[model samples]
Target: MQRGLSRSSSLPATSELGDALRACRGAFLGVGLMSCMINLLYLTGSFFMLEVYDRVLPSRSVPTLIGLIILAGGLYIAQGVLDLLRGRILVRIGTSLDEAMSARVFQTVVRLPLQSGGRGEGVLPLRDLDNIRSFLSGAGPSALFDLPWLPLYLAICFAFHAMLGLTALVGAVLLVLLTVLTEFMTRSPARQASGLAAQRSELAIASRRNAEVVVAMGMAGRLTRRWAGANASYLAGNQRTSDVAGGLGAVAKVMRMMLQSAVLGVGAYLVIHQEATAGIIIAGSILSARALAPVDLAIANWKGFVAARQSWHRLNGLLRAMPAPTSPMQLQNPSQKLAVENLSVAPPGEPRVTVSEISFVLQAGQGLGIIGPSGSGKSSLLRALVGVWRPVRGHVRLDAAALDQWSSDDLGRHIGYLPQDVELFAGSIAQNICRFDPEAKSDGVIAAARQAGVHELIVTMRDGYDTEIGEHGGVLSAGQAQRIALARALYGDPFLIVLDEPNSNLDTEGDEALTRAVRVARARGAIVIVVAHRPIGIEGVDMLLVLKDGRMQAFGPKETVLAQVLQRPAAAPIKIVSDGGVSKP
Candidate 1:
């Protein structure tokens, strides 16, 4: 009963594989029909030979025999052509499925919430992608195509002799058992191997990122040692999986030989007893071996299936984990007005909210400067307003509508957000800025770059905005990359702009230019919110909000908050008015 319950609980093992096959079910059906036709032809030819041996040969009807041979040749040629067409169609189907599954996996990875710590760097992503690819490419469809062949082969075996048919049936059952056992035994190690592979991929990425630093510090030897250690661990894990799989395969080999010998021996005894003819027994033996062929192929490729299954689950889990938009509430058209009410922002795996019960608002044409010490939740507050972190206890709004009511795509279109880390892709600069918006013309892109103070730099490039920038804008300076990223945000002319420490990497001239851009945006009736740890050029603007110890310590105009915090004695720590319950003086 426990075993039955366990089997029931396992994700309908057929679903993922079935879905993949059904994606190209037409080609699969064609292959099946052709296989059946081939088998029928073979059976007819076999019976023809049997009749010739029993009657035609004794009668010496050479003309009839020759005609039968010619007919058999024609059938054989027709079967070959059909088989070839089926194989070509099947290959096309497999290729299409591979491309589709790979695309799905890639899309899923990109949509997953960013992971922090060491978890994000390792082999998890690659393993998932490779698993999905391998499944669709071969392991999945191979098993699917075998399903129709199994019963068909069984029927053919049964028609030859009852005893041989019974023996073949038993052999098939044992072969399936062996394959399942092999799959079960190798599954755990394959998971470990996949995990190790993920880790290796992450390490390689990290090592590349730190390559320049290592070389500058003359620590190449040390870095190499660390990399070697990681590789060694990955190799060891892979070998363990291979060892288990190889061991199980050896055992299955022995079992298959024993089972086949037993079937042949039984068939021989039946022939001696005249229970079946020589041709019948011969055909039965061949059919029994053929029946086991699919099982053997399945067993040999079980590792790929296990890997793919793990990947499929990984992708499913990713989609499951994304937060749904707030239910039933509707924000059909978002506006520029941004408000955060009694908001609490918490990072992943954190017990305490970083910013608690904080409330602020940014009206159109209003620019607010958020200033605090490091780790004061200034950036956290910005993230919350942008819907990156949905508040635990309170609501966020845009134009009096709940922020959660808006879908991610709609939210992005309405609000322009630039995180501290400026990431660029390996593509032409214009492509990176416009992203999926193909209608963004060259003039629009150049104008955006000019507004972000990056036009001069872009024009200097050999191909202007068409020039390719390597991964993460490796060819550009920190300030240049930040400016280009800002241009990307500005390309859409979003009504609400949220900038987190935008001036940190800029020189004095660049900082002033960015300040001018913000002023220009404000002039255009856009709301701008800037989160900065230090004094910024945007300091003398409108309102200020200070957060500390997860509570709003002060909220008012910039002068009011700064003056109140500065009134404390020279040696004493600055103290601003807190919400009373959540913080201490």
Candidate 2:
């Protein structure tokens, strides 16, 4: 299981996303330029009305009127073309942003379990990325881009008349204030709604995943009520935000419409007083409407803007907290020298340690059996050994190098692990046996199956190695899934194998297969550690490690530990001596 040269060195820490945005700066610039031209051309309609009223009609020249109409049509066509170009540029920018961030977001999701020790939802990051992409391509950002040109339109209004300009400016300021009010009123409630929505989603997912249990236990009504409570909370928060934003939006719309009419009224008064011409009166009304268009649009889409902003902050914070990928040292594959020094591990998000100050060492070709009652930190220790759970203190080393020093992908190739609850992904039997390695060879897959003693049983299926396993291997029996998971752990002849309850679902034949697999792995110069409750599961193990209440009880050759355990009084607490010895109470 040799790895290729390190590719992580080429990946920048948080700069790739920045670089992607920078790459699109030119495109956004082009969009801005097009928007400027589009806004400038928007005056064509006002100008057309002005010339027809003031010049064409008075002059009574059909040629002048026809020429103005043709020129206005050409300007409208140019504006349409620029509008289309800018829209296309925004769409391309959105696509480019997705292309740049999607892969990295997916990578982060895949590594989340390892980084957080199996806590957190993996799908949320992708959802956040999608939110960002949608916002970038949508009408919301287009309105923001046009917003800066509002002043230019108001200037055009001022050139028409000072009273018209003042009316438009006051209207714009009021709408801007309304926009701010919408944000202030809805921000907290919107954030609350988003969080509640996520919680409701997770709850629904959990309920669906355990639908069978809920049905068998007759918990449908209770679970439904529970879900309903969460949904109601989500709806309440959503409604509050919508009410505030919608109310402000309606007021802003009314204000803009009234302001447009008010501009026309003011311009008419100015015209009557001979302060402005009839053409300027009509032009002022049109320009005033144009100035407030972007503000209206921004208010209409305020909720979407808030959602995208929150998603951006969340995604940025998550990515920033993630450790930067490092170029792993080109270390040779370990030859089964495993060492755990003063290791302590706690559950994720919990302060209490599950396994504490445990230490051990094993050389190549040795097999150790760990036996303990439930909740004795058996599985926790195994997780630490396989690099699934990082140590809270101290370290686990392979061949004298800390496990954290290796790239996860490279290290996974040399280590095999089977958790207490075996789970097989949705795929063919061959794929699961090969650990889903796309480049796995057929021979290697079959060899691993044979090593796990499930080759003959697998052949009995109609599709043999190609048989499709349903989700979580639901199509298979408990014993069948356990054996297949063992085969997966034994795949690629990994130097270090950690198995938790490998024979919990096995029968007589399956138990014999388990023993044979362990013996073969040991003979091939691998370090094997099995966590079991049954004595038969430890048949060929050369050493034994006993744990009780998160502390080591005994660890030595299998025969010596077994003898010591056998001699202890059955009803009394086993006394642990300071010199790694055990005595009866």
Candidate 3:
């Protein structure tokens, strides 16, 4: 079921990712300070080379040489500690990002299918979030942080010699151009790869879900061929992106190395001409390499950078499309009635309305049966009634308050639903029946099971209530899963129970048990709406609605609607069955 979409309003425009990062901004500031210190300390080797060559070797002073070595070693250690600390801070920032937004990301994943009307579309948001966090924590971010200090190293190179500075500056420009080229060349292919990957993943998931059909019908080879074609497209796109990034990264590395050698050769000429000391050669080479190191690292990690950037944009768009909903007030548990006014609902993520202009009112203790042909929207109506699909044009009111006026968490507690396809989480039978309530009482679980008339079947198992149900209740038969789902719907004795094709898989015994459950629900003032094709499935509903082509054809008390649709005589009597007797309505 779609959770929290019915919340009355959306929040104001804001970047959720930015907001999450801001919560961790203090640590970021601290990391920046450390980067500043670390970059300054990077100058140690250059200066030590300058000092040792220009002073110590010429003077032949052992004490001075030893002191310089000790000082330089200490500075190197400090830089290493600070660098390590900065990396740790980046990791923590990633952790902070996850801690702040993982829940929101998961919530969006759940709600995404409701908007897109597809199961696999939701898988990307969580993956996007992971991509962002991984980039932040990895060496990619450190390369970014180190980039700003490039000019500092360039200035120092100029102080050593003008030619050395010119060499380093030209290398920086070339590397920057190469980085830009990599980005432009790979962007389109990267985007195409991501789309193809999602498509391939969705197909694989769908094929696996219907694996039984594939194996039973001998169509495994056909699916495999289709899947292989999609995989080939994805691989081609991915390969193109990697080729651009990888080739440019190699160029950047070679250019940086060439720039370092050119600076050294320039320093050698300057010293030979007696315009610079011998130490200038080593110092200039080291400084020029340091200046271009960040650019080199960035080019090497360009693919990761692009992936992170795209993920950021996708996350931004998703958050904008489904802005965080404002928390609605807790409304009273709906008791007296359930009303749908001028309602028209399309399938989730669909544009054409499938159930149109539906208006109805069901009083407390009344049970409604929705009957129609396969294409007549009986199941769609039930979905809307339980707040799964948002109506394009109407209100689903509970008591006097609209459904949107209640928080989904609170509203969920008051409404129970069983969809046409039964799904059971992997857990013990007791957990499935109690809807996984942490504080569920065993008595309530037993009561719900007994009400569904599945208690006898459940207790026959070796572990009984404690028996584990595998994913999708893989160990249970079709009839057993349906019965357990019914028990779940009746778990809390919710004010309204919406069931779609409640007995589509049931045997005769199961059908009789379902009728008793509906009777028990109405006896306790809980409204029941069952969408069913079989007449036996409507056994206890007080009201009946017939539909054709998404529009209502007839609606009223069960017998009256039946008689009118069947063209019965006006004088004919209709028998309405209660627990053990019949009455005239």
lDDT of 3: 0.86
The global C-alpha lDDT for each of the candidates, from Candidate 1 onward, is 0.69, 0.86, 0.86
Candidate 3 lDDT over residue span 291-317, tens digit each: 889888988988887787778778767
Tell me each candidate's RMSD, in Å, in order: 4.7, 5.6, 5.5
Task: Name model 1 segments beyond 4 Å from true.
Answer: 1-9, 12-35, 38-71, 74-107, 114-130, 147-163, 166-170, 217-223, 247-276, 323-336, 534-536, 570-585
Q: Over 4 Å off in model 3, which ranges?
A: 1-13, 567-585
Could you say which candidate leads in TM-score? 3
TM-score of each: 0.83, 0.92, 0.93
- Best of the two (1, 2) by TM-score: 2
- Report, for all candidates in order, the number of backbone clashes: 3, 0, 0
Worst 10-residue lDDT window, candidate 3: 1-10
**TM-score: which is higher, 2 or 3?**
3
